[model samples]
Structures are given as structure tokens and as C-alpha cells.
Target: MNSQTELAALLCSRLCHDMLSPVGALSNGLELLADEDDPEMRKRCIELLEQSAAISTNKLKFFRLAFGAAGGFGDNVPVEEAQEVINALAAGNSRIELNWAVEEQSLPKPAVKVLLNLAQIGIDALVRGGTLDIGAEKRDGNVEIVTRARGGKIAFDETIGKALQGEIAPVEITSRTAAAHMIALLADEMGGGLQYALSDDALVLGAVLPQPEGMIG
Candidate 1:
């Protein structure tokens, strides 16, 4: 399969995998509520349905910005929007603490994608729930993004690392590596590269994208 087609399939697969749990919960809750006669149990079912719907909505918002073309015709996205989606995603897991250090009012679409994707990866790495530190800035005519996951236990995926560095063959890319692969492609196209450092307690991902002329004020 061609790289673009494969990438699309992989991303779709990843989205499906993420959405199944919450969507399924919603369905199950509806089923139970339909057959229940107890008011208390019906209330509990409705509450679960609400939670599942919220989770599904949050995921959709995050994927829309991170993986899909959002912001309409604008070439830049407000940093505050990115922060909101990331915060919503992290809210699902209360144990994760997010630190936003991005001072730029907005970032190029490509840079925003990298920032959001890296933040997602960082959140995943914090298996035991810890701090997710995200920062982005403009320096030396380039947009720099850094995301760090710090926890007592870090689940570092070697395949993802390889994907970020363009070490994986196109035919081998899977749903798990699709985001990283896209990030690598974006960095390369923008005259930059992806970097990462992995240890027992932390996983740090960084990217630098050359800012387009007239993009900065």
C-alpha cells in the first residue's frame, strides 16, 4: 500500500480503538436504562451514559485538531484551543497533572499538530499517572515544542521511538506508530527533525519546525 493510504488507515484504526470503549459504554448504558424499572438504577445508568458521552466528545475534539484539518481556512491555530483539548483529554485521568508553558498566542498548523500529538504520546507514557509538561515557543525563526512525561513508571514504546526517527519501514507502520510517523514526516518537511529521550521515569519528545516567512509578527 502507498504511504499516504497506509497512514490514513492507521490513523483511522487508532481513532477507532480509542473511541470504542466510551462509545460502547454509552450503548451499554442505554440498553440497561431501557430495561430498568428501579429509579435509582435508572439514574445510575443515565449518569454513566453522560460520562461516556463526555469522553466521546472530548476525544472527538482532540482528534479533530490533532489529526484532522481544523481551524477552517486559517493557517494558524490559537494556542489556547490546543491547551483546551489537551486539558480535556488529561481530565479523563485525574492522576495526570498537565503543565502548559506555551506562551505563543498561536502556532502554525503543522507545529500545533506536532505539539498535540507529542502531548498525547506523553500522556500515554505516564502509565502510573504523573506530570505531563508541555512547552512551545518561537526561537531563532523556528517553532520549538517539547513534551515530557514524568512518572514513577514510564511505558516507553520502542516501536514508537523508531517511528519518530523514521527507522520503521512504511509497510510496518501500525495504528500505534501512525501519529509518530506523521510527526516525523511533518518535521522533515518543515526542515527540522524529531528527538526524544527515554528513561525509566520519563519520556521526553521534542520537535523544531522552521517558521514560514511572515508567520511571526
Candidate 2:
């Protein structure tokens, strides 16, 4: 397949994989609600359904901004909108804490995309739940992005690391590394680069994108 087609397919697979559990929970909750007439059980089922629905919504919103076409035709997107989706995504896992500090009121579309994707990766790395620190700022005509995950355990995939470094070939990209590859491509396009660090309990991903002269101010 061509590069665009291949990337799209892998991304779709990733989205489906991430969404399955919550969507399945919603279906299961509905089924349980229909089969039982007990008051307390019914209440429990409703609560579960509500939780699943919120998770699904959060994932959809995050995907829309991170991977899909958001911000309309504008050159920049509001920082608040990006924060809302990332916050929602982190909220789904009570065990995970999020710290956001993006100083810019708005960021270029490419910068926002990289920021969201890196944050997503950081959150995913904390399999056993931990803290995700995300910060971005405009410095020296560049947008500096950083996302760090700290937890008891970190699940940093080698393939994702390779993808982020532009070491993975287009034909080799998979659902798991599609976002990483996209980040690398975006960084390259913006005359920037990607870097990362991984240890036993932490993973840090970063990108430096050169902002157009008037984009950040």
C-alpha cells in the first residue's frame, strides 16, 4: 500500500483497538440492565454505562484532535481545546495523574498535533498508572514539546521509539507505532526533530519544531 493508505489503515486499527474495551463495556452494561429487574443491580449497571460512555467520548475527542482534522482551516488551534481533551483522556484512568503547563495561548496546528500525540504516548506508557507531565512553550522561534511519564512500571515499546526516530520504514508501520511515525514526520516537516529517553520507571518524549516567524507571538 502507499504511505498515506498504509498509515490510515494502521491508525484505524489503533483506534479500534483502543476503543474496544470501553465500547464493549457499554454493550455489556446495556445487556445487564435489560436482563435484571433488581433495583440496586440496575443502578450499578447505569453507573457502569455512564462511565463507559464518558471514556468513549474522551477517546473520540482525543483522536479527533490528535489524528483527525481539527481546528478547521486555521493555522493555529486554541490551547484550551487541546487541554480539555487531554484532561478528559487522563481522567478515564483514575490511577493516572496529569500535569499540563502550555504557556502559549495557541499553537500551530503541527505543534498541537505533536503535543497531543506525545501526551497520548506518555499516558499509555504508564500501564500500572502514574503521573504524566506535559509542558510546551515558545522559545527562540521554536515550539518546545515535552511529555514525561513516571510510574512503578513503564511500557515503552521499541517499535514506537524507532518510529519516533524516523528509523521505521513506511511499510513496517503498525497500529501501535502509527502515531509515533506521524510525530516524526510532522517534526521533519517543521524543520525540527524528536528525541526520547526510557528507563525502568519513566519515559520521556520530546520534539522541537521551528515555528514560522509570526505563528507563536
Candidate 3:
């Protein structure tokens, strides 16, 4: 198989892994509700159902914009909408706090996708729960995306770093590195570059994409 074919397969695996948790919980909650008899237990089951549903929905929304075809060509997507999806993804983990600093009301869909993917990686690096601060802006006629994950016990995957830096060979990529790989691929296609700094307590990811006219201000 070709390199792109392998990347697509690995990405599918990652999306399936990510979706399985909440979706499976939702299914289990529904099953439990059906078999539940006592009123109190039934109420508890309902609450679980609600929580699972919210999680599934949030993941769906995030994935739709981040991976699927939310809107590839047209008016730029509102930054608020992009931020909301990132917030939703972060909300799943109470340990990670979100600080959004993008001032633009909207950004090109490609830029937004890159932002979302970077945010996802940062959020995942907070192994012990930490601050995930994200910021984006127009600079030197390019969209500069920045994300920082700082915590007590942060863990940065080496493969992810290599993937984002365009150092990983596609054939060696796995489900875990798919998101980073995709971000690197997109940035390259846009005549941009990706960089990162990882340490014991902090992990930072940045990307610079050639900005379209009037897209960022």
C-alpha cells in the first residue's frame, strides 16, 4: 500500500478508538436503563445516559470539524464555533484548563482544522492534568497557531513530536500519531511549517500557515 493509504488506515483506527469510549458508554447506559427496575436506580441510569450522550455528541462535533467534511470551501468558520468544539473536548478532562486567545471572529476552514488538531494534541499531553492554553493570530501574512500544555506530570509522545515535525515515516506511523501526522501534512501543503518544544512539565506545538487575504485581522 502507498504511504497515504497507510496514513488513512491509521487515522481511521484512531478515530474509532476515540469514538468507542463515549459511544460504548452510551450504549451500555441505554442497556442498563432498559433492564433497570428500581426508581432510584433508574434515575441514576438516566443521569449516566445523559452524560454519555453529551460526551458522544461533543466528540462527534469536534471530529466533524476537525476531520470530517464540516465545510472545506466557503466562508470562513467562526472562531467561536471552533473554540466551542475545543472547549467541549477539553471539558471531558476536568484536570486540563482551557485558555483561548484567538481574537479573530473567523478563520479559514483549513486554519481552523489545524488549530483543532493542535489543541487535541495539547489536551492529550496533560497526563496529570494541567493548563492547556491556545492562541492563534495573523503574523507576517501567516496564521500562527500556538498551543501550550503545562502540568505537574506532562507526557509528550516522541512519535507525535516527530510526526508533527515531518520526521516520521508514514509507514511507521500508528493510530496514536495520526492526528499529528495529519497536521504536519496539512501545514506542508499550505506552504507552512510545524515546530514544537517538549520538556518535563511543558509541551508546546506551533504551526505557521500562509494566511489568505482578509482571513485574519
Q: Which candidate wins on lDDT?
A: 1
Candidate 1 vs 2: which has more lDDT = 1
TM-score order of candidates, top first: 1, 2, 3
What TM-score, over all chains together, does every model reach? 0.97, 0.94, 0.93
Better of 1 and 3 by lDDT: 1
TM-score: model 3 vs. ground truth: 0.93
| Candidate 1 wrong stretches, greater than 4 Å | none
Residue-by-residue lDDT tens digits, candidate 2, 1-217: 2568878888899999999999999999999999989999999999999999999999998889899888645788999999998999888689999998787788888899999999988988999999999999999899999999999999988889989989987667888899899889889988899999999989999999999767756
The model with the greatest TM-score is 1
- lDDT digits (tens) for residues 1-217 of candidate 1: 3668878889999999999999999999999999999999999999999999999999999899998989535799999999999999999899999999988889999999999999999999988899999999999899999999999999988889988887888676889999999889888988898989998889999998999778865
lDDT of 3 by residue, 120-163 (tens): 88888898899999999877789889999999987777888998
Worst 10 residues of 3 by lDDT: 67-76
lDDT, model 3, position 136: 93
